[model samples]
Target: MIVGTAGHIDHGKTALLEALTGQAGDQRREERERGMTIDLGYRYAALTPGAPLTGFIDVPGHERFIHNMLAGAQGIDLVLLVVAADDGVMPQTREHLAIVELLGIARALVVISKCDRVEPQRVQEVQTQVSVLLAAGPYAGAAPFMVSSVTGEGIEPLRRALLAAQSEVSQRSREGGFRLAIDRAFAVAGAGIVVTGTALDGRVQLGDTLLLGKAGKPVRVRGLHAQNQPATEAHAGQRVALNISAERLQLEQVHRGDWLLAEWLHAPTQRLDIELQLLASELRAFEHFSPVHVHLGTQDVTARVALLQGEQLLPGARMFAQLLTNAPLQAVHGDRLVLRDQRAQRTLGGGRVLDPFAPARQRRSEARLAQLQALASADSLEQALPALLACDDGGLDPQRLERQFNRLRSSWQLPANAQVIATRQGPLLFTREHWQALQNSVLEGLARFHTQEPDQLGPDRDRLRRFVALALERPAFISLVDELLAANRMSSSGPWLHLPEHRIRLSDADALLWSQLQPLLVDGAFDPPWVRDLAKALSVDEAEVRVLLRKLGRLGQVHQVVRDLFYPEATIRQMAAMLLQLASDDPVVQVAAFRDVLGIGRKRSVQILEYFDRIGLTRRVGDRRQIRADNALAQSPGQ
Candidate 1:
């Protein structure tokens, strides 16, 4: 268990830590000379013999160094809120208490220091003041311990209470990838570089490779110490110092607020959707787009709050908002954050991160708001997923879903109503209702199109996508189409997509004209005649021949290689087979070779190859084309 000290400056916080640990707390030269802690100080000791070590973080109580105090406050199990009996409930004391409350640190032990210097009545007065302060916060029932650091009065009892509280400190869940917020970094003799911080989640073993900072520079852990004791590995909720090394890493490149993370947990973002509360202490309302200092983990960055609910947030009220930071911040769901004024002078309030990957636009939409509300009310992804999927129509990316929740795929408690559809991008998660609705929408859409235009077969994939009138990603929609085709619920011919039951046939007059046209197209199968030439040979109007051929093209009876040019569907299939044979020798099918195989002119070969490219049969790269393995034509001519 880690305990942090919080109080006004010169309240003997560091001195109290020294008394408890039997070790000097103010080890810095400046701190010893000034008789105050200028920065965060640390001490570790087993309060009772054979008991687990209890780490102590003695934070500077000066208002100017509140940022330093906040750095040490994160990941602590309990807080020792020290109040000097001689100066009861000072300004920094109140601010520190408010910070602890905002940080959601529920366990606190109030300590009234310098009791020997004050009379019993004065000590009682300080306790009453502390009680009133705790009454409105999470530490309401915490009893105060009176002690004089100089005399060691009541010291033994305070140590006993700390041991008792340590038993009640629940262990942090070790379900996420390892992450440590770096607060101090330096070089040690014979060691390349070392970084110390509280391990926020997961575990790290000796020789484990971890990514460092937002740049994700890879580093190997050479050694580690957990809770100030050398160990082979360290897990969450322990103060740890890692001896890390990389080829390019230097002490200058690392600083406070940088993170040591597992490879899968290295995503850093500039925007965070959060549930914020305005402190009742604020005299004025917090306006939209208000600039403030955002403190999460051990990092402090300047950010502007974009209010999601209203133009202004009243003091003492809670609201959801998005924070747009000037620099990237590494955060995950449920991570606590504090907001100070833009000047970084005073604590305004704090909040919990709801979504680290916040959308830049439409964040105020009803659907988005509902999703945020769901995320706010739930503690885990499993609890919030039902409402989230209900509001999100596009379905969730399984990769992002797992990453957002900081859990591995094996640990996810996926809902039974959820469906996973495989796409080239990754697996997409959709509620069964939403998935069925998408499939039905496609079928119903094709049926409606057939009814409206009985002469036309159906729209192509791109046109069908637009016709559906729903916002689905292209990859996911392609996956949906493939699934339907595999299930025999929908079918595609050439470039057109339609329901299996929908079909278009040539009218009798057009059919008769098509019969006369088929002979001309098949006679020179490799180099079909243009519509104007066919019409001239048949002694018919060029416009009529063009209309008849276009109708045939729609019914998959003919291929329109180019404007006014048509080929018999069988001839096109034969040409595709020839190209595939050429591609077998070398995947790159050049135009010269294709033209030679078809015994056609250069222009005719280029046109036919371009048509093949258009239908996803082949992809053209420069002057050569590569056959697409997934193309049905490549698999077999009958397809």
Candidate 2:
């Protein structure tokens, strides 16, 4: 369990910590000279034998160092809100209490420090004032504990209360990828670089490689100390110091706001959609697009708030808003953030992040707002999945979804009967109802296409994708088309896709022309003739010959490799088989290997390979091509 001290400057926050742990606070020369805490101080104690250690973070109480104080507030399980008995409730004391309350720190032990200096009546009066302060907000029932660091009075009782609260500290699950917001980084003599911060999620072991910061530089964990003791591994909910090693990595590259994270969790974004609340103590309303200093984790960046619902947010009111930052920051859903005025002088309010990767357009659309509302209400990824799928019309990106929840893919609790469509990019998740709607749209679209153009076989895959008029990704749309084809609910005639019942045949005149063209194409088999050559051989007009061949191309009798060049349907199938056989041995089929396989010249092979790419028979990768098994032409003729 971690406890943080919060109160006014010179209010005995550091002195109380010193007395509790028997460790001196205000260690810095500047702090000692001034008799004040200028930065955060750390100490630990084992309240119970054979139990985990209790860590203490004594934060600076001066308003100028509030940002420093905030850096230590993260991962705290309980707050020690201190108020000097002589001073009663001071300005900084109220501000510190408000900041903790806005941060959603519910467990607190309000302490009236320096009780020895004041009379008994004065101590009681301060206690009564602190009780009233706690009576409001989330800490309504919290009681005060009076203690004096100098006299050792009420100190034992406070220690006993903290020991009892240990059992109540809920352990954070170490289920996701490792993440630690670095608050301090420096170099040691022989240990190389060392970084200390709170482990936010997952676990890390000695020798494990973690991506450092937004650059995703890989670094090995040489050793670590968890909860102030040397350990081989460290998990979430503990204060940790890691000795890391990497090639060419310097102390300058690692900053206080940087993060040590699992490789896949290194994404940083400039925009965040959050559920914000303006502090009731604010003198003015929070105007939309107002400049503010956003503090999340240990990083502070400038940003402008974009209200999702209204032009301004009144004090004490909660609303969904988007924060646009000037610099990128690492964030995840449910992470808390604090906002200060543009000048970075005072606290305005804070909120919990709802989405770290917010879209740039249509962010305030009705559907998007509904999705944000659902996200705000959900307590976990499991509860949000269904609601998100229902409200998100553009479908869910599986990678983004996993990152939003800070959950590993293996640990995701997917909704029952959830449909995951395999795409080239990755898998796309959809609910059954949405999946059905997409399928219905495709079938209905084909039906309308048949009605509009009875002469044509149907639209090709690319055309059909556009005709559907939906916001489906190309890979996802292709997967849906393949699913429909495999189920016999749809059919593909070479490059064209249509309803299984819809078929096209050549007219009588075109059939006669095809008869003359068919033999010529079959005879030329491997090296087909151009439209002009075929027209010259048949003693027919070039335009007439081209028109007839196009008709046959739609009927799946011949393949138009190019605008003029054509191949018999049988020849194209033979070429597809040869490419597939080459892919069977090695998925990447080079132009040279394919030319040898076809026993054709390099030019002809290149032409055919380019044509295969156009018809989706293969995907080109630099000088090679990968045969696509999902393509209709790649299948055997019997199928």
Q: What is the C-alpha lDDT profile of model 1 across 207-259, one tens digit per residue?
A: 99999999999999999999999999999999999999999788999999999
Error of 1 at 559 (Å): 4.8
Looking at model 2, residue 328 earns an lDDT score of 89
| Clash pairs for candidate 1 | none
Q: lDDT of each prediction vs. the true structure?
A: 0.90, 0.87
Q: In candidate 2, residue 357 scores what lDDT?
A: 96
Per-model TM-score versus the true fold: 0.91, 0.89
Candidate 1: TM-score? Answer: 0.91
Q: Give the per-residue lDDT of model 2 (tens digit) for 1-639.
A: 889999999999988988888888538898888888988899988765776789999999998999998888877889998999999998888888888877777688878899989899998888888878777677776777778899899899998888888778888889888999898898999889999998989999999999998788999999899999999999998999999999999999999888899888888999999999999889888899999999888898999999999999999999999999999888888888899999988999999999999988888899899999999999789888888988765568878977888887788878885788887778888888889899999999999999998878888887898898877877888889989999999998767888999988767888788888888889887788889999999999999998888877777767888788889878898888878888889989999999998888999999999999987888999999998765667767323
Cα lDDT of candidate 2 equals 0.87
Candidate 2 residue pairs that clash: none
Off by over 4 Å in 1: 519-528, 558-562, 566-638
> What's the lDDT for residue 432 in model 2?
85
